[model samples]
Target: MSAAQIATGEIAVGQLDLEYVVAARLTLVAHAHARGARLTVNGHVAVNDAAIRVGRVHGITRDRRGFHVHAVAMINVIEMAPERAVLDAGNTILGNTIQSNGQSGVAVCCAGVTNNLVRQNSISGNGAAGIDLVGSNGVYGVTANDPCDTDTGGNDLQNFPVLNYAFDVGGGVIVNGSLNSHANTSYRLEFFASDVCSGSGYGQGKTFLGSANVTTDGSCNANFQTLLNSPVASGQFVTATATDPNNNTSEFSACAPVIAFRLLSIKRQENDVHLMWTTLAGKTNIVQRAFSPGGSFADIGPMIILGGTGQITATYIDIGGATATNYYYRMRLGP
Candidate 1:
């Protein structure tokens, strides 16, 4: 059945004993289903592009295998018991846009619901989480329900974390991005740096800079800040990935080029001047000096290589400069 806007008090689309069915592009508003009357099925079934709102009970529930919900919009619902989008394990919920629901946007509320892949969907503005794995005494715990759980070897989730560097006082690199998944859950963010940018081989020799755990805000947004050990040069590539608490990690985001440094400090020493900086690994820095501040600076030393799996602090020393003449120094990354 397809392409119908259902406005009745209750409508049953599929039977419990039916097999091989498809329901698509149906819109239901402020509706309900009779008790025990749901879109039940036994074999393969698909529900796509359906808009369901203000559902008094379960909306498009399933109890059997081969059920899939894609591109469906479910909003302002009270509950998604037995699973809002799927019940049986291995079912798929892909590209469905859900928001502002009274309960969870996607849920696994019953036993035997495992290995469901919930991917690439916009879920937010809900009363509860964008996704939920509710466990009860009637069933086993909600383990391995989210396909993004790496411990169970589920499907890989994909996320991109944005990085911003601040060079001012008390500054650090700020990483911020949004992931489309269950809200209020902690995910690990792994940062990597590469010497090259924009190629399949670019990140091949990438170095792991650091990692931090961040819990998604109510809106599924993640933000973190950390000081780097070395100075990241401009044009170097950087990328990040998200790993759920279960240790399942999403694919790395598209590599972005490093544009600036988080911190650079210059200090005058008794005989030699000291230059210190902090940045990610895998970046190369060139230090230069001039007789006067803002004058033409020439390369004074060899390129400094930052090597490690985390933030790095690098220092350079300039010796035998006329203390009374006032020498100037600056650092820049190699191309």
Candidate 2:
């Protein structure tokens, strides 16, 4: 059955498995199609084999990935935590401290939520993603799942607040927007730093991918419309194309006609900070220095937190220096 067709929340009340869920491959949806699905469980489930699997695909003909282990089962019983229901389907997980168990937190695919107003939920301990925004766009987004479950949940409500990011994020947050935003539209993705994420991947790459007049913060950057028709840097060859998961030339990873260098500052925290950042296809190499207005930077070894594979992530800890002193910093990129 399709994920969108079988998103059932018919739990066995107090019983772990009042029935049996046997399928070589299972599709995960928001809730198959149940209303008011709140997750709240504490215990163990008996999948026998692959009782509860995460990340769904129609079926892969090639050898399955190690992340996809094999098991045997008949009466697979899963018990979830209290007040925790699977977040709709198609996940684009972009939060902190997420843990994947059998069946407890969520069972997402690609494309998680957007512009979530999270506060302080421990996002790293869930069975699936603490908070994901995966979608059916497939290679169109981040991961791959059965597009069949596209009708899992509604995309209106914002999500939980995760301060840390120590778990796994198939689709790390994409900052600096991308190379293909319209003149009037703004694409923003924000995150709350914490012990889990520890300020992972901060200002690691481009905030504004296009070449033109715009504004940029350490966390975000904007691009102008005309910049899309300009020339690149002298001898600086960055392969440009209108390709992406969705082939939307005006998308985050889409290649604009040109690009320009811009700076983005980091969000200041009262305590020790954990930083993170992402690099799409066409963006200037990130140059992060600690000392302000021209000072030395902290050495982070070779590779300077690169984003070669299209998406790069980095983590750093601030010892917290005096207010008047110039902190250390550094930068790197495709240029």
Candidate 3:
């Protein structure tokens, strides 16, 4: 097409699917300048163009709640300016492989760009973050997570999920993390895996694993654990994002590497305790003990085991293990 296909004015477009749309300027522009103007673009491949643009433009009324861009691929650079593959959302950007763009893969720009759900997408190889939420300070990239997520800008400056650990079991991956956000709110958490973290140090969703829904407590805290059936091997990295009840999505969390170690079993025989764990080859394991769940854990001495080349089960025995009133044991991959 000589000019970009434009969707404007007050109308409801059901589905706009573009295959091989190429242009020097914008390929598809969905501007919600008129009230009740709704659009959904899906199964598209836009290269050598500004690709797909969405939001309120032209100093007019905003669009309604039906704008969505999903299941598309927007790679290749046209470098007109620092333009994102998709921008300025009060909508959803879901299940899109947006990579190597001139700017961010997807960005929610400026104030009042709320309820933009960015989920289930492999967003990487961009110049900026995979999902960039403009901070209240008018800066780009990941805004530091504030207490209770009170700060506001793009997507209300939504706080991303901080992962405690990601472990690759034999069958699947177990991911554990927590989200601190608006009180008594339900949020959607999406997990992704990457071979390496993005340059920005926040992260990029290289491979979408799975998603879970969590509701925060009165203290604005939600602890979640999910088992992802996707094929994520040990040594790969995992990341996650949080989308609030308003569909406002946050940036990718800092990458957490998938660990190959797991504390399998613990048994007590009289005053002795036996511990068994799955360990990676040529890796060192450390055992720690604590009295309470929230208490400090100290390393148990003279019990470290060095693993072999194959995945093997290692065992350690603690003499006089019943000396303490209560005991908790944990193992970690050591040096």
Candidate 4:
């Protein structure tokens, strides 16, 4: 359908497959005037046209929710700025290919744009971020990860996952990272692979690898170790996003290359236990000690907090284990 408006009660809840070319805009007018509208735009193809847009521009009071744009191809938008291949909010944009557009491939604008889940999409070669969040002040760009995630803007300025290491493990890729945000919260992390990291070092989610769910600790910290079934080649980079329980998606995290797995070394220094390890630079490492081989390990501190720049050897001295006859020491990566 080139230009169609979904009015109230015309189509309550279903899928709208647009195989034909869309010369104009297919707007969901149901949300602009009414509320409780649920629809999905599936398998649509739009080229050299205005493409699809959801929700109205300047009416936040109107309730527009539950729209899904899935498995669609939107490319080469002929429209000028302020019009993109897909402009939406309070919806889900998943598994679509949106590229070479006038503005961002998909943009969520205005003040009240929230709970819009934009993930697992091949969005690149666009004017702005693969998914750009335009704020109430009319500012549109990539927002950096804030400490504690206290700030709020587009998508509540959700904090993206900081990837520490991603290594190709023959059949799959092992990704390790952490998210520091609201305490005692659950987040859905999505991983992606790309040939090159974006210039901003944020994201350009090219290939969706997989996803994992994690909940942060009381300290607003959550560590994750996910094995993506996708086989990423050496030198390729992996990026990820964090979506809170609120369904607000963040910008892409900094890319981490898929390299070899990290190695660790352990030794006994008289009565002290000496441990050393090395991994990707900028990784946070902690030393954990266990009484028995299979016992629960607890973090040992006072001299073992490690984080650095170059690929240097990280050492931890554990004198507390001197008295223990049987002590197992190992280093853990990430928070």
Scored by TM-score, the top model is 3
C-alpha displacement of 318 in model 1, angstroms? 9.1
> RMSD, each candidate, Å?
14.4, 17.8, 10.7, 10.3
Looking at model 2, report the run of 10 residues with the lowest lDDT sum: 60-69
Local distance difference test, each candidate: 0.46, 0.28, 0.68, 0.64
TM-score per candidate: 0.34, 0.25, 0.62, 0.59
lDDT of 4 by residue, 1-335 (tens): 22344321233233444443333233233223323332212212232322444332322121232123332222323222223533344666655565655456665565566787876777666666766665667676776676788776667778888987787767689998899889899999999888887677766777889999999888889988999998898678888888998778877788887764344666777887777665455656677778898999998885344355434566777775676778877666654
lDDT by residue for model 2 (1-335), tens: 34322233333222222123333333222232323322111222212112233333332111111011112221232223222333322323222222333322322233442222222122333333333333444222112122211232123121111111111112122112222222233333222222221122111111212322233334332332222222233112121111112211111111211122222344446654434554334334444556565655554434443345333444454445334244545444532
Better of 2 and 3 by TM-score: 3
Candidate 3 residue lDDT tens string, 1-335? 22233323222334444444332233332333313322322212223333344322221122231123332223322222235644455665655566766567776666777788887777777787788888656676767898899987888889999987677877788887899999999998999998877765678878989899999999999998888898798878899999987889998998887776677889889998999887655556788889998889998876465644545678888889877799998876553
Poorest stretch of ten by lDDT in candidate 1 = 147-156
lDDT (Cα, tens digit) per residue for candidate 1, span 1-335: 22232322234454322222234223333234223223323322223234432212233334532123422233222222322343334444434555444434455444444555444344444443344443433222123223223222122323434454322113223333444445678876666665653333212114555667778766666566655454455556666656565433343455555544433677777877788886555667788888788689999878988887345678888776537477777776553
**Which residue ranges in model 3 land beyond 4 Å of their true spot?**
1-82, 263-315, 318-335
Between 1 and 2, whose TM-score is larger? 1
Ranking of predictions according to lDDT: 3, 4, 1, 2
Ranked by TM-score, top first? 3, 4, 1, 2
Model 3 lowest lDDT segment of ten: 58-67
Model 2 RMSD vs true structure: 17.8
Which residue pairs clash within candidate 3?
none
